[model samples]
Target: MFEGVDLEVPAGGLLVAHGPAGCGRTSLLLALAGRMRLSGGAIRVGGYVLPAAGRRVRATVAVARAAPAVALEGRLRVKEVMAERRLTGAGVTERRIREAFETVGIAPRGSDLVEDLGPLQALLLATALALAERPGALVVDDVDEGLPPDAHGSVWQALDRVRNSGPGPTVLAGCVRTPPPASGLVALSLPRRSLDRLPAETAAAREDTAT
Candidate 1:
């Protein structure tokens, strides 16, 4: 839905993809994380290139809470989710989970269900889960949705911490609007283009087929 968008993010930097809905913000993040294939153009994440080396890229990239692709099921408990990640071969452990929780500054009870978390807490949990994997890059979508404007800073700050964490993973986060500037935080705006008028299902089908 967008065209001619070029990006260059430093390792461990936070790149905010900001735009209105249907402007390809989510698509761009997915593509960068190697979770979605691009119809055109090239992407290079560290030493890996798009599409051709997608498998290698995916091995070191983690996508979290990026709707439809990665999301917490309401019925699952916090500990269950962590266990599932471990089952999937992520290096998830109680200690790593604790580290992630500390970085995100939240500690939901292990017995608590995903739905019980508030908006910010849910986001924080997703972030922690992704970070616990220790991926080379992390992608998060809708970073500022379902919360008050005042609370936006918390999400940004948590992401900043992720960026600053030692040998941090490159972070790609989406938002409806750009937040204030911060060190190593870069903002890229995606304007709605003609292709954005395509129906959602059609876009999804295109992504599915390409990938």
Candidate 2:
């Protein structure tokens, strides 16, 4: 559990929730996406208040790579995954699927199995699926997970492209490692898990000072 965490990212910008393992970054992202409930405090996404308007917030936010709710099955083919999502009412079009692959700089054959994809490729696929929904905001967790230090740059770059893609939805990502500086990048670091119960205002103040 965490509290007093606050942030405001402009449309089309990227916000990285930076922290170490078990620091609640993933939970934070999940809550922001309206997939998890908040025990206290408040969240306002676009013009909608969370919990009170959670259904609308869930409809407005697309979450990828957060697990349980949004995960790509390795046994599925790329095309099969796209087809399933469309059938489930993600509203992703054939044209948008192709554009999402291009947006993330991948060219996977529709026949390729998700299990055969490289780390960055898998991430791109998850991201592509989320983008296909065309939500007002997109949340992705573990931006640098499983990627080598050298390849971290590539992952961030792809996300940057996603941020700039058509309509440019606000992008929020969770990362164990802080990202290098980039245009429109906002890094918000969380305190240690031991401080999880710290007063809300104090946490917000710490965030401001650290950033």
Candidate 3:
């Protein structure tokens, strides 16, 4: 439950929603992706109004949730996921999917079951699926989950590259800690609100570096 939470993710830019637990970081991401409903507050995605135009917003936004909570249906295959993305997404080609898979570094045979991969690989697979959509906007929750500290840099670097790519998707990613130093990455820190005061309100401090 959060109120007075405002955010601005520039077109084709990267915004890192960084905060500790219980700070409504997950909620914010869910709300933006139209996965969660809000009681009040106007939200517009890619110029379309929210809740009313939620379907359009959803079409434009792709989400990759935390690995533990977001399971691939038992024995689901990698190629099948990419195939689904191609069917649902615009201008998606098999080569594009392969490129995304390569970028994520998960090259297990497409015949392999989702259960076969390790946690990190599964996360990467999910991420690759999202990237395959080439959506107008993408939201990835718990970007640093189940990843090594050193690998965290690679994740941020990848996201930054995605954001800076030519007319690529605008990205909003959630992380419990800071990401690697990079320009054009806006880090929005959700301030911890005391339960006694403003128990239902949430606020974010901008660490904008949009140059």
Candidate 4:
């Protein structure tokens, strides 16, 4: 659990929660997304109340989990997924969806089967869908998962490109490890564990400083 944790990200800013596994990074994202309740605290995200006003918040907030949620249905073509989303409820156009794909530097043909994409391409497609939603806030969990160091840099660059564009939403991501120095990301050096242990460690450090 976290205590006295304060986080602030300006509109369209990128907030990266970097920590080891089990450090409550994903939990914090859930809380901010209103999927989980905050025990006691005020939360204002995308102009909606958190924990309490979850449904309302969800409208303007979109979340894309790790590859587990990146399934694109093998039989359907790449653009078909985008079509399905628009048919269901998204008011976004094909051009807009294509633009999202372009923004991430992925160009899957409309007729391409979902199964054809490699792991990274699949991930990019999932991200493109999230961007298509055009939510006020976007949260992506486990960005660094399953990526080697070489590809990690490229992925971060792509994510950053999307994070700093026109009508950009507030972007938040959680990373378990790697990407040694997470520069250009707000809150990049998040601790590896819960803040429950922080106060005592901080106090001891202060005592040593005082001595």
**Candidate achieving the largest lDDT:** 1
Which clashing pairs does model 4 show?
none
Error (Å) of candidate 4 at residue 108 is 1.6
Residues 74-96, model 1: lDDT tens digits? 89999898888777746677788
lDDT of 3 by residue, 1-211 (tens): 4455555556777778888887777777776776667676657676666667778677777786643444456467876877777886677788877877777666868887777776577767777777777777777878887787777877776676666555567787888897666666677787766322222332222112121
Question: What's the TM for model 3?
Answer: 0.79
- What lDDT does candidate 4 reach at residue 39? 67
Q: Positional deviation of 37 in candidate 4, in angstroms?
A: 2.9
Q: lDDT (CA) for every model shown?
A: 0.77, 0.76, 0.68, 0.65
Question: Over 4 Å off in model 2, which ranges?
Answer: 195-211
The candidate, 1 or 3, that scores higher on lDDT is 1
Q: Find the 10 residues in a row with the least total lDDT in model 2.
A: 202-211
Using lDDT, rank the candidates from best to worst: 1, 2, 3, 4
Which whole-number lDDT from 0 to 100 does residue 71 have in model 4?
Answer: 39
Tens digits of per-residue lDDT for model 2 on 1-211? Answer: 6666666777677888888887878787777787887676667777776668889778878887886567899999998988987876466787887888888888888899998988888988989888877777788998887888889988888889887876767788988887889888878888776534422421110011000
Model 2, 160: alpha-carbon shift in Å?
1.0
- Following a full C-alpha superposition, what root-mean-square deviation does model 1 have from the true structure? 6.0
What TM-score should be assigned to candidate 4?
0.77
> Which residue segments of model 4 deviate by more than 4 Å?
1-4, 66-77, 111-116, 178-184, 188-211
Sort the predicted structures by TM-score, highest score first.
Answer: 1, 2, 3, 4
